[model samples]
Target: MNNEKVTVTLELNKDEARALAQFVKRTSHSDCEDKATSQNEAYLMMDGVNAVMKSLAEEGISPR
Candidate 1:
């Protein structure tokens, strides 16, 4: 990974922020690490969340 970092900003309402925080709280780590392979689960999760945010933005919809 590169030694670069970013600070993203979002203007979410209290309810929306709380909901996202709750979702993150409920997320569980997967045990996909066997002796031979290690999975990049965080990347998978980030991709999914990014896709959802992009879709909502394209549709001009707010997540409930």
Candidate 2:
């Protein structure tokens, strides 16, 4: 696979930017600084949403 670099600009509040920087520092220690890192994070968030939805469904609550 060819490795090319892409640039993405994000506008974050000061607190959010600091949090993202801290997260990057922590995850980079585990060798997770790559394109797929954000994708993995997104999947993790989606999984949490799915779990919440499942619990709500069990309680007969509509999440519409």
Candidate 3:
């Protein structure tokens, strides 16, 4: 795998962000992992997703 990293910017409304967080939370690791990527990369991606969820909660945009 390439070690290069890229930045991604999204423009999601509060509800959309909340829904995305919930969806990521419900997704299984095996279901989300790609056949070409390493396990560590998948875990790191999950960690980044978790960070976004936490940030959304901090902004008071959590799911009911």
Clashing pairs in 2: none
**Could you tell which candidate, 2 or 3, scores higher by TM-score?**
3
* Top lDDT prediction, candidate number: 3
**Local error of candidate 3 at residue 39 (angstroms):** 0.8
Number of the predicted model whose TM-score against the real structure is largest: 3
TM-score for each candidate, following the candidate numbering: 0.48, 0.40, 0.61
- Stretch of 10 with least lDDT, candidate 2: 27-36
lDDT of 2: 0.46
> Residue 8 of model 2: what lDDT?
42
Residue 45 lDDT in model 2? 48
Poorest lDDT segment (10 consecutive residues) of candidate 3: 27-36
Candidate 1 vs 3: which has more TM-score: 3
Error of 2 at 25 (Å): 32
Quality of model 3 by C-alpha lDDT: 0.71
Which regions in candidate 1 have their CA more than 4 angstroms from the true location?
A: 31-38, 41-64
Which lDDT values do the candidates have, in the order given? 0.52, 0.46, 0.71
Question: On residues 33-56, what C-alpha lDDT tens digit does candidate 2 reach at each position?
Answer: 242357666555454445444544
lDDT over C-alpha atoms for residue 60 of model 3: 78
Candidate 1's displacement at residue 9, Å, is 0.5
lDDT of 3 by residue, 1-64 (tens): 5657666667788778878878867756665476328788777777666767777777777666
